[model samples]
Target: MKKIILYLMSAMLMVSLAACTPTQPKMETTPPDPQVMASTGGASDKVPDPNAEPMEIISVYSKNDNKTGLNQAMDAVDKLTAEAMVSKLIEYGVLEEGTKVLKYESADGIGTLDLSAVPQSGSGDDKLTIAAIGNTFIENFELDKLKLLVNGKNYSSGSIKQGDNDYLEYVKNYKEIK
Candidate 1:
């Protein structure tokens, strides 16, 4: 009887341990590659899966071009949701390297995007940067409004604000940067 109780206790402990935050990024690729592992630094919940069927990433905004301010382009992602496509944005140099999407959910036309360690935009183009990130989630998640959060709390930087009245709207006029 004692052995049976000990075994049950051990099983329950193992189950409880599995519910904790993972040590590695939740890349569904079974076998992780070195580049993505180092890039996201386990900050992402969903990473691209090479073995999985890639989905079309609607628009990955980039400011790499000197002439065009913010340009939109398409790419392939492992998953078909905005959460999965966020890693692609990091790869494209849109969101900073350390930026992490902690939680994402939408309902009643409002999408809450919780991030971690978001870099503050000090330049005069904070609106453009906000549009790039907001539109990505808005267009992809099909939300009429966005609530950006940092570390599960409200976020604000430069011209951006995270409050009930500070929701962001979608802007679809970004020219492609080629």
Candidate 2:
């Protein structure tokens, strides 16, 4: 009789201990939809719609020291048609204060940007300023690449060309100046 009670008590203890073990919650593995990605400000490679009506939206980035600032969103403008958007970028502090866009036009999906003025001093500032303008045009418009001209001269004398990925690569690789 003692052996039977002992076995029963041992089994009860084992059962209780087994019940006390914790379980891991099941995890979800599905990707979110594109609308969810956009609303959350997640980066997406989806190109802008060319046929949609034009409006203005600010796409901002900081070159160094992650700091957030004020932003107001509206419909994105048609970059090809909106010359004022470049001026507005300077006004809104998206571009540097003195940056100027003399002309912005596209032919056969290749964009040509004429800048009346650009950052002259500080290698970091020059890189970021150029990248900001080029990236803004590339991201906003349906362009294969951009030809940047300053004061009616080719930026870097045929060194910056489309289809070779040099310009895009440079803009992307630009490290921020302190």
Candidate 3:
């Protein structure tokens, strides 16, 4: 009787221990819906749309920095803006005989740019260059507004200092794009 009782208790304990053990999460083996799968095509089907509108790059000008003076910031801005402009021009195939950007007024969180010094290349690279230049201007200037002009004419949208809407849209539509 003692032996039988001991055996029963051991079996009960074993059963309780087995019950307490956690079950593994189930793996998904079945393929997704055929219609959804067809729409996606394959893993490498994602590509950037050329027809999509490019994101706008906002210009950021500096107001005041205690650590770095406005002069230092302005100097940095000059260098960066020049480089960006050059790069954009080159990318847009608009390299001309005498293309230069002169600083008209840059102070108190405002940058007045003069492009009259730049010769007309007519390379159709202006748009590409402007995008690059605008993006660069925004990144380095830290200013509130950057006014762009071509040959002393206000050709572009007045300010490149706003936030990037395209980037935000991209982030939001990532799932759809993917």
Which of the numbered candidates is closest to the native, going by highest TM-score? Answer: 1
Residues 1-178, candidate 3, lDDT per residue (tens digit)?
9999999999999999999999999998999877656555665677877987655343332212231211111221224455455444444433343556755456776655566443332433333334334444544555455566666666443332223222101111211211
lDDT of 1 by residue, 65-146 (tens): 6634677778766676756656767876667776777888889999988877666775535566666778778877778989
Q: Report the CA-based lDDT of candidate 2 relative to the real structure.
A: 0.58
Query: What lDDT tens digits, residue by residue, belong to model 2 across residues 44-111?
Result: 55578899786656453334443222233333554534365566556545565666777777888778
Q: Model 1: which ten-residue window has the lowest total lDDT?
A: 34-43
User: Poorest 10 consecutive residues of model 3 by lDDT?
Assistant: 166-175
lDDT value for model 1: 0.72
User: Which residue segments of model 3 deviate by more than 4 Å?
Assistant: 1-97, 117-127, 156-178
Query: What are the lDDT figures for the candidates, one per model?
Result: 0.72, 0.58, 0.45
Q: Rank the candidates by TM-score, best first.
A: 1, 2, 3
After superposition on all CA atoms, what RMSD does each candidate show versus the true structure?
A: 22.5, 12.2, 15.9
- Residues forming the 10-long window of minimal summed lDDT in candidate 2: 66-75
TM-score, every prediction: 0.60, 0.47, 0.32
> Could you give me the TM-score of model 3 versus the true structure?
0.32
